[model samples]
Target: MQIIMSGLIMGCIYGLAALGLVLIYKTTMVVNFAQGEMAMLTTFISFGLLTKYNFSYFVSFTGALIVSLILGAVIYAVFMNRVQAADHLNQIVITLGLFLIINGVAGLLWGHQPESFPTPFSDKVIPIGSALITRNDIFIFIFTLLLMGVLYVLFNFTKIGLAMRASAQDLTASRLMGIKVPLVFMSTWAIGTVLGSVAGMMTAPLTFLSPTMMFDILIMAFASAVLGGFVYMPGVIIGGLIIGVFGNVVSYYYSPEMKVVYTFLLIIIILYIRPQGIFGGKQTVKKV
Candidate 1:
């Protein structure tokens, strides 16, 4: 039960992070290698707001999300927009460059030390059958579920969401339909960044705040996204949960160090058996 609970908590975090990556890919066709670093940077911003300015946790959280929105817009306007017409490799290289730059900036600003992040949730341990878990764990689960619910409503019942979907499916057609494709693209990045920030802030308390802290989680997030069919948004969550449970089960039964190895092995096996991923749909072939 303990291992299962741990996996679910961590899986929610991975799902949020993977959502950001998949969002960018769906809209801009770019695999954002910088997603984790961007999240780390925003998480540090929240840390600074909490520690340096002594803001309340709620205020710091709101401030960090606002910063994330602006950062995402600026990045898209100044960097990603310029490479929009480039080939896939060029676009990917730009994201990789962003990954490096964000990491360096985070290290320089926050230094190399890991710090304990404060959370509003109580640290008191609670018993669940034979397993013990912190209140924070339960809070994290509730928070993630609420967040996903909000996203579902936004995407399903909002005009901006409709525009984003149109833009993702057919950018040229969206423009012809007067959808302001550029604005949609910018909004997509902003939304994705905000999601990433939420994941980062939640994860910091579990894993300590540091520049390199998100790298490992990022790997799992990538695995999750790929496993779920990178273009499918909701499937990312399922993929994350699967990866998380698989990792935890492996760790419990085998060596903890072998968990990551086996997780990737699982990915390879799953992909080999079902190349389109668990939820990936049929691909459309465009014949010349």
Candidate 2:
């Protein structure tokens, strides 16, 4: 039961992490490989606000989100926009370069050491039907659910969300309809960065803040996004949960290091069986 609860908490974090990847992939058709690095960098920013500036969790979280938004916008404006006409390989390479650059910056700024993070939740545990659940785990689960709900509402009910979806479907048509494509793209990147930062800040209490923290998680997130068909929100959540649980189970039964290996194997098998992924719809490409 303890293991199950732990998996659930970890699964929520993975899902939230995957959410940013899905958003960027859906809107721009470019996988921002620097996503994990962005998360790491934002986590450090949150830490700085919390420990150095003596800010409360809420204050630091808000500051981190704002900074992440600006960083995302700047990244898209400076790097991604230039690659709009480039091929997939070029885009991937550019993002990869950004990934390395951010990682180096993090190391230079924060060093390679891990730091403890404080959480609002107490360390007390509650027992329910022979299962023990910690307050931190409960907080993580509840916060992730609330975040996802807010995202759903924003995407479904907001005008900006509608424009984003339209831009994702057809950039030219959306532009013709007077939608600002560049702004939409920038907003998408900002949204993705905000989500990633939120996930990073939340997970910091459980995993600690470190430069390499996002590397392994990024691979897990990419697998989750790919398994869920990349762009589907529900599918991404489900995929993350599946991978999280499976990895936990494998670690419990086998070795912890084998989890990533098994995940990659699962991804290869899934790709072979269904290249479009579990929830991906058939896309018709219009020839230029």
Candidate 3:
């Protein structure tokens, strides 16, 4: 039971990581391959603030978020905005370049070693009947759920959210309707970066801070996003939880090393069966 609980906590973190991917894909129709690197970089920022300046968690978190948002905006202004008629391949190449740059920068700044991170929750474990859960696990689960709820409300009830949705659906139409399309695009990237940074901070305590931490988790998060449907929030969350639980079950039943292999296989099977994703509807392509 403790193991199951641990998997669920980890799944929530993956879901948060995938949420950033979904946000970017939904709005821009571009998969930012650099997302993992962005998370890693922001986490390093938090670590620097905490270790060098001895800043509080909240302060460091805020600073990291701000820096990440600025980075996201700059990436868009410098690269994404210039891709006027570029294909998906071009966008992917650009993002991949960003990924290498960020990864290299992180390694240069922090070295290739793992660093300890302070957790807001106590390390003590509490027992509920036969099941034992740590405060950190509970904190991660609750924090992720809270963030999801906030995002749900923002996308469902806010005007800006509606504009974003409109832009995603039809950018030219939305622009013609007087919406600030570029701003909406920038906002989407900003939100994605902020969420990614938060996921990084939350995960650092569990996984330890390393230059390559996001590299491994990024694959799982992408699988989660694909399994859930690129634009479906609820589906993404459920997919993440399923992957987390399933991976752990596999690990327990077999070797722990097979977890990633099983996850990728599961993703491939799901894609083969439902290419639009479990929650995604088939999009009709208009005849040109």
TM-score of each: 0.97, 0.96, 0.96
Candidate 2 local lDDT, 1-288, one digit each (tens): 656667777778788889999998888989899999999999899999999999998899899999999999999999999997799999999999999999999999999889999987678889967778877777778888898898889889998899989988988899999999889889999999988887788778888789988887888888888888888898888888888888888899999989999988988898899998888878898898
Report backbone clashes per prediction.
Answer: 0, 0, 0
Model 3: per-residue Cα lDDT over 82-196, one tens digit each: 8735899999899999999999998998899898888876789999777888887887888888989999898989988999899988877998999998788888888898888
List the global CA lDDT of all models: 0.90, 0.88, 0.87
Better of 1 and 3 by lDDT: 1
Q: Rank the candidates by lDDT, best first.
A: 1, 2, 3
| Candidate 1 lDDT trough over 10 residues, lowest sum | 279-288
- Distance from true location, Cα of 31 in model 1, Å: 0.4
The positional error of residue 270 in candidate 2, measured at the CA in angstroms, is 2.9
Instruction: List candidate 1 stretches off by more than 4 Å.
Output: none
Model 2 off-target regions past 4 Å? none
Error of 3 at 259 (Å): 0.8
